[model samples]
Target: MNLPPVNIENIDIKLRFGNFVLNVLYVKFGYFLSSMPEHSHSQGSYELHYIPQGKGTLIAQDQSYPITPGTLFMTGPDIIHEQIPDFNDPMAEYCIFFEVLPGDSTPAINRNHIANDRLMSELLMSTPFWIGTDRENMMALFEMLASELSIQSVGFHHTVTNILEIIVIRLVRQYSLHTSSLHPVPLKTLDDSRLLTIENCFLYQYPSITLKKLADNLRLSTRQTERAVRKQYGISFSEKKAQVRMSAASRLLLSTELSIYAIAVQIGYTSQEQFSNAFKRYYGMTATQYKFKRI
Candidate 1:
């Protein structure tokens, strides 16, 4: 049987998302499911990884970073890297692979250059990595991007690209803020027209969303909205919402110290008992048990 759909709606917003062109290669998140040895990306391909929880090690070009909660790392196309998840404490991270389009804004430079004339070019030239202090915001974006790709909803290709653009821009901003460099990366330029309308809706409203409420927010009839969603993901609207909520709950359970009841309410359930039943149905274990298993 086909699985339930992931929630990945987009909406319009006036943020300076990005100016550089980008093409997404792949996006995914979960436990350590692979045992690939050291590998390198194809030409022009780059990788962005976010480790929301657990501990491990990331080795790139012989440079290593301790993978911990809230760690974000970006690697150039030529860098050789190996992901070593702690065997007993395996990590869960969101990874996106893509390539930046050649353009006038990105200076032509050798991949080995640690510094470049332009800030954007320098970012691409060097291996940019960060362990962020506030992870909730970043994890939410990763969750949404993963949702879009996991479902492969209609128009999801474009939606995934849009979200990745935002992620790249955010990283650039972080790099600029911390690095002491001669060139400053432009932070307010944009090139794509895909708005964050539906994405914002799910990000902010997923906790307590109803089909009718969701339809009204998007300004479409309930039936029309349901049809559109079904056409895109092959699942009912309610199923999609539950999937999103459960996904978020799983993340919070692994990363935060919140109590079961608090997490239940945070994800929009009225009571811990209700959330526990639903969680058990979706994950085949209780929330407390799931948390302990990861510990």
Candidate 2:
């Protein structure tokens, strides 16, 4: 069967936990029709697994965990693990390999206030292995990652990296929920400055930015992100995105010698015709007319 791309490697994400940088070594997604040989990660590394479909068994450290659809687990730092897919219904897997290494110190104020990065790092490292069903419905995010990477649209790299960060946060949240030592915290609303930062994403990443991506960046839920946007800008996310794109289009048309098609592609339109239609709707004139009239 045709699968979304697999064996995605060497992705750089600027997600930090205290002085440690979270490095994504690779990501893989496929169905396991056969058994996987026992494997172990090196020191300071983790392999996060999510099973979106089928049944299987994960053997780790001589313990067996029944893997079902929505199972999310992590094997960390030298933990030997293997997977055995059910022949009747083979397991489909999404795996992310990552490492955390010491880096620059964190700033005094933690803007993404779900938890301090130091605490997050401590919690993640403290657990050597975990197996449980996903409560956050993270399959959607994984699917989004697969789609974005496959399409490689404008700002796709940024979207994928942001989604990875959100996955990390969700993983932390799931861990905190089950652990007795810590509890999950509600995400705080973005302040005006932070909201402005999100607005800047709309300005720069107009081609590929979505409300979901913006929410992931802010570490807030999509609904919360929408509310925050409305509160801060007095406009919806789509409206703001369109405004930014059209404004940029107007400037490029006036200042640059690029053709209409080039301007459309640069501003995120898939086709010149599509861009022309949107330009007319926004400006009430054809792009060529606007350019000649203004010039």
Candidate 3:
């Protein structure tokens, strides 16, 4: 009855992982379940969309990005966008739009001019974004949001806001992790604390990383550094670095509509072909195939 009250386990999991609580204040419905015409977010309210089935192309601002099942797309007050679904495949999505005042900590509105203002153009060029997630974690977040919104009782807004805030923060972390790896490093590590700190930095910033540099930062020999990671993760440092880079690469291909070239640069590959080859070897599929698969 009542669709079994949705799934509350998802709510608990999301809450446990993110420590984010939100209340939805309002919602605007869409008319086209089978088709979405050209549209835009030119005002203050924002929209969060999650696709569960099918593939499509979304034109956000002036740039177009492909979309697929499990895709999450968010737009803020400053942008305009349209949805172009792949009719060949069935599409299922959960989306909602709402507003927050100035100073609100919302990703859709809290970005810099380059991002919030012209993200479409930036996305078109090669600026990387991130959203591919650990499946359990991602599912928990989305299911919780959907459950919170399904409520017809009182005081829903506050709960939805808390959820949205938490989700947006996680998305921001994803973006920071993916982008920083492509960016630069600020300092070197010299101790255990510093090493952990450096590791966190690499994870967040996506710095070009190496064992030699890590050992130099920590004043250890390269072999010592390799031994440490091997001892802890049961994998060689080389394997670990490759694993992390691959993880980031997979995220870029999925969460973003970035081209193979753009995604390559973000994940430390110097060229698109190199990235494609490595991705195929590791994932057993080309980046494009992998991206469309929604794994």
Best by lDDT: 2
Candidate 2 per-residue lDDT, tens place, 140-176, comes to 9999988887777999988988999889888878884
Q: Backbone clashes in each candidate structure, one number apiece?
A: 9, 0, 22
On residues 35-72, what C-alpha lDDT tens digit does candidate 1 reach at each position? 33444443344567787777788876657778887888
Can you give the lDDT of residue 86 in candidate 1? 83
lDDT of each: 0.60, 0.75, 0.51
lDDT winner, 1 or 3: 1
- State every prediction's TM-score relative to the real structure: 0.45, 0.57, 0.38
lDDT tens digits, residue span 1-295, model 3: 0122232211211111111122222332222245453333212234566666577777665577877766776654334355666767645555544332223333353446435434322331122223342333454666666666677357655675566656655554444332221222112223324334334434544437777777776677888877655543446777766766776676567667888898888778788888789889888888888888966
* Candidates 2 and 3 compared by TM-score, better number: 2
* Best-fitting candidate, scored by TM-score: 2
For model 2, state the Cα shift of residue 61 in Å.
0.6
For candidate 1, the C-alpha RMSD (Å) to the true structure equals 16.7
Tell me the alpha-carbon RMSD of every candidate: 16.7, 19.6, 19.1
